[model samples]
Target: NECASPQKYHVDCDSNAVCVDTEEGYSCRCRPGFADISEAFNRLPGRKCVEAVNECLDTRLNQCSENAICEDAKEGYICTCRQGFVDASPNITHYPGRICNKPRKPDDDHQVSHQLDSCNPKDPRCGNNAICTDRKNKGQFICECAEKAFRFDDGSCRLSAACDVSNDCDKNAVCANVFDSYKCQCRPGYIDLSPDPETRPGRYCKELVNECATNAHDCSPFAECIDATDGYACVCTDGFSDTSSTAGLLPGRKCSNSSNECLDRSTHTCDDNADCIDTPDGYNCQCISGYVDVSSSANLPPGRVCTVQTTCPKQKTDLMFLIDGSGSIGSYVFKHEVLRFIKEFVELFDIGLDRTRVGLIQYSDQIRHEFDLNQYSDKSSLLHAIESTHYLTG
Candidate 1:
C-alpha cells in the first residue's frame, strides 16, 4: 500500500494533508482544521494545504449570541454564556438564534422577558422590582413600579424614599430618608416658622431671633446679654453678682447688688495715686485732689494712673485724701477709724489759704467732693468740714 510506506515509494504531501492509498497510487486530502490550496485531491507533485482562519475572530463566522463569549478551537469555534447571563436555548450547545437571559432569582416567578413586544403571559419580562402587564389589544406589554412606595428609575424600580446623592432639600436644610418617604429638617441655630415645620415644603428654615441684639431677653440691667443658639444668656456684669438660686445667670436673675471689689484686693486694680470705688454699675478709680487723671480714655479703665499736678495755682499746696466708703467698711469704722486717721494726718500740715490747703474726697457707689482747697481757708473750718462728711454706706 502506497500510504503505509510512502517515504520508500517517494510519496510526499503537505504537513497538514493526510496521505491515502488510492487504486492507482496515492492521494492527499487536507485535515479538518486545514484548507486545500488545490481543490482536487490526487498524488500531484505540489498539492498544498494551509491552516484555516480563526472563525472566532469574525462575528459572521461564529454562531455565539451577542451576550455570549466566543472561543476559537483547532477545528472550529465555541460559544458560551457570559458572566451573570444564562443560556436559554433548549439544546446545550450555543448556536445562532440562541437566547442569553439574566439569571433567575428565587422570587422571580412574576418576571417577564426583556423584549416588550415578545412578552408572554406565562413568561413575563419585567424584573422583580416591577410588574408587567400584557396589553393584548395593543399587541405590547408595559412595566410599572410594583408598589406605591416604589419609583421608576433607569428602566427599573427603586425605593421612593431613597435620597439622591445631591440632596433635594433647601440650602439651610438637610435631607433625611424615612421609612416611606424623605424629610427636610433645618440645621442647628435655625428656625422654621411653619405650623407643620417637619412636613412643610420649600425654604422653611430662617435665622433664629437675636435676643441679645433685639433686647428681647429679660436679662437684668446689671447683666450682659449674650446671644446663643435658639436662645440668649444673661451673665452678671463687672462689679455685680448674680443672686439667683440657680448656678448659671439665667434670665430675670437678680444682679442688683454691687460687689465690694475694693475689699477684695485680688479683684481690685487701682493705682497707688487713685482709690478703687465700688459702684452700682461697676467700679471706678478716682484721682486725689493733688493729682490729676492722666489716663488714655476719659472713662478710666482698670489700672489708671494719676500724676501729681505740674501746673497748679501759685501759693497753693493742695492736699487731697481719698477714702473707701463701700458697704464693706462699716459706719463705726468710717466715723472713727477712717475719719480720725485723716483728721490726725491733716493736723501735722498747716491748713490755710496760702499754706498747705487740704481737700477731702470720699467714694463708694458715688464720688463726693466734700470740700476743695478754695472752700476751706482756715484750719478750724477744714476740721469741721472733715467731721461733717458722713459715711455713704453704698
Candidate 2:
C-alpha cells in the first residue's frame, strides 16, 4: 500500500497529517488536533495541514460567562467564577452552563440569624462622632449621633447653632451664628460702648458721625467738605478761590467771588504766542498777530497752543528789536550773530506800512534809534537796513 513505505513509493503527507491508503492510490488526512489548509477532509499531494488555533484566545470561540475568568486548556478553555462571586448554577459547573453571581444577603427569616452572627462589635465600619448599632436586617448596621444639638455632616457630627434673623439681637447689632454658639456684633460706623462686647447680653453702640459723606456740614455748593477728627473743614472747588478773610478750614469760609488765575504766572498755562485774559469764571487765550490758535476747544484750560501762520496774515504789526549794545556783549556777537538772526526773523513777516512795519534800536547806558517803524516800506529795504546797523559798545 501507498501508506506503507510512503517515502520510497513517492507518497508524502504533511507532518500534522496522516497518509491513508485509498482504493485508487493514497490520500492525506489532517489529524484530530489539526486542520487542512484547503478545508478538505482528505488532501492530495503538495497540500498542507496546520495545528488547531487555541479557542481561549478568542472571546467568541470561548463560551465563558460575564463574571467568569477564562483559562486555555489542551483542546478548549475552562471557566471559573471570579473572586467575591460564586456559580449560580451549581448543577452545571462547566463553561456555557455555569453562571457567576454574587452571594445573596439575608432577606428572609431563615437567613436573619446568619447576618447577626457576622457582626463584630470591635470592628464596626461607622466613622467618628457616631455610634454603630446592629439592625438585624438586610442592611446589617446603622450610624447615629449621640446629642440632639449635633447634626450629621459628611461622615461626622458637627455643632450647628440656631440663628435666623438680625432682629433676634439688639437693635444696634446683627446676629451671627458661629460654630459653637451665636453672637451679636455692632454694625459699621458704630462703636460698642459695652465693657464686654463678647459676653454682653445687649449691645450698646454710639453712632460715629460722618458729616462729609452725609452732607451735614454748613459748606457752600461750590466748596467740598473734608472730614476731621473734631469737625469738618470746607475748601473751594476748582475755578473758585476762597474769598473769606478767615482760613480755608474755618467754619464760615466763603467762595463767592471768582479769582483771577491769569495774574499768577505759575497758575496760567498760556502759550508764549498767546495772551491770557481773565474772564468771569475762567480765563481766555488770545493768539498774537501772525500766529493762529490751533486749540481744539476755546473753553478748554489755558494750555492752548498758537502756531505760526503758513501764509502770512495781512495784519497791521509794528515790530521792533531792542538790541543790547553794552560793553559786556562782544562786537563780533553783535555784528555777525545778532545781525544775521534779525535779518532771518524779519524775513518771516510781510514788511509794509499797511501790513507789518520793521524798526531797530541800540541800547547801552544811553539809547540810540537806528530806524523807525515808518522808515522801511519793503522787506528787502528792511533787511538791508538791519544788516548795516552798527554795534555801539559803550
Candidate 3:
C-alpha cells in the first residue's frame, strides 16, 4: 500500500504529476503558467503594470493650451485645435486649451537698439555757428567758427578773418588770416601788451613817449616841441630861426626852407628836355630843349657887362637879398655902406667882369630904383649915385 522511496517512488504516480523526492530529486512538474493548485510551488517576483490613461477626460492633465481638444494617448496627451484659433493668456487664465501658435526665435541686437547713421555723437547736435560732418555709419564731427569764433585743424572748429570791421581784433591788434584760423598781432609802431588779445585792445599801447630816443629833437632856437595825446606838436621858440622853411611841415618839423620842399624833393623824372637845377626841396630849370632867355640889352653904359654868353650852363645864378636899414644906420652911413657894397661887388667878380655886370638898387622898406646897368657907365659911377642916396626912415 505505501510503496514510495528514493529508489522506486515513480511507479506510483506517473499520470497525476507526482515525483520521487531525494536530495537530487524532484521528478515531475507542471509547465509554466499552469498551476498545480494543491501542491506547494516556487513563485517568481512580479512587476506592477503601468496602465494607459485617457488624458482627454482627465482634468488634471491640463494638456491643451486654449480653445482646443486634449488629444488623449496611451502614454500622455497633446493639444489639438482646429484652424484659425488663438488664445492669449491660456496659462494664467486656465481657460480652454491654447491653439496652435508660431514659435519665436531670440531677437538680434539690431532689432532692439536705436541708432543714427550720420549724426549721433558721431553726428551730434551743433553749437551756434557750427557745422556737422559725418564720416560713416556712426561717425559725426563738428566744424565751424563760434560766436567769438576760433578754429581747429582736425577735430577743432575754426574762425576766419574778414577784417572789414576793426573790431575783428583788438583796437591795437592786426588780425591776420591763418589756414583755418585768425591770429592777432600788435600795431607796428606801438608796444606794451595786455594778457588777452581780444578783450584788451588799444589798452596795450603803453609805451611811454621816447622823446629823445629817436629823432625827437624836442627843441630848437627856431622852435620847441611838445607831446600831444596821439603824438607830438611843436612850439615856436623865443629865439626864432625863421622856421618859415617849415611853413606847412608836419611829423618832421624842421627849419626847412620856407619855399616848398616839394619843389626840390620830388621823385618825378625830368622827362622834358630841361636843365634841372636840383634844390633842397625841389628843382627849377629852363626847358632848354625849346625855350631860351630872350631878354637882351640894346644899348648899355661903358664898362657895364653886356657879353653874349650862350650854351646855357646847368645853373643860372639868381640872387635875392633882403637888407635891414630900419633907421639903425646914419644918413651918411647908408651912403658909405652902399658905396662899400658896390666896390666889393665889383671886386668880388673881377675875374668874371666880362661875363658879369653890377646893378645898384636902394630899399628902405620901400624899394627905390636908383640906376640900372643898362644906364650906368661903371661901378665907380654906380657907387657915386649909391652914396648920394639917403637912408629912408619909417
TM-score for every candidate vs. truth? 0.26, 0.22, 0.22
lDDT per model vs. reference:
0.62, 0.62, 0.41
- Judge candidate 3 at residue 164 and give its lDDT: 31
Runs of candidate 1 exceeding 4 Å displacement: 1-195, 198-234, 237-239, 242-258, 264-276, 290-394
Q: Which ten residues in a row have the lowest lDDT in candidate 1?
A: 37-46
TM-score (C-alpha) between model 3 and the true structure = 0.22
Candidate 3 per-residue lDDT over residues 32-150, each given as its tens digit: 33233221111111111133446678667665655455765333454534232323323311122343332222243334232322334454575433555543435445343344344
Candidate 2, 246-317: lDDT as tens digits: 444453366744777788877778887888888654577788887766553233454475667755436678
Runs of candidate 2 exceeding 4 Å displacement: 1-313
Per-residue lDDT for 5-103 in model 1, tens only? 878887777777788887977777778867554422222323567688887789998777787677665445656555444455454321312445543
Highest TM-score against the true fold, candidate: 1
Residue 234 error, candidate 2, Å:
86
How well does candidate 1 match the true structure in TM-score terms? 0.26
- The C-alpha local distance difference test score for the whole of candidate 2 amounts to 0.62
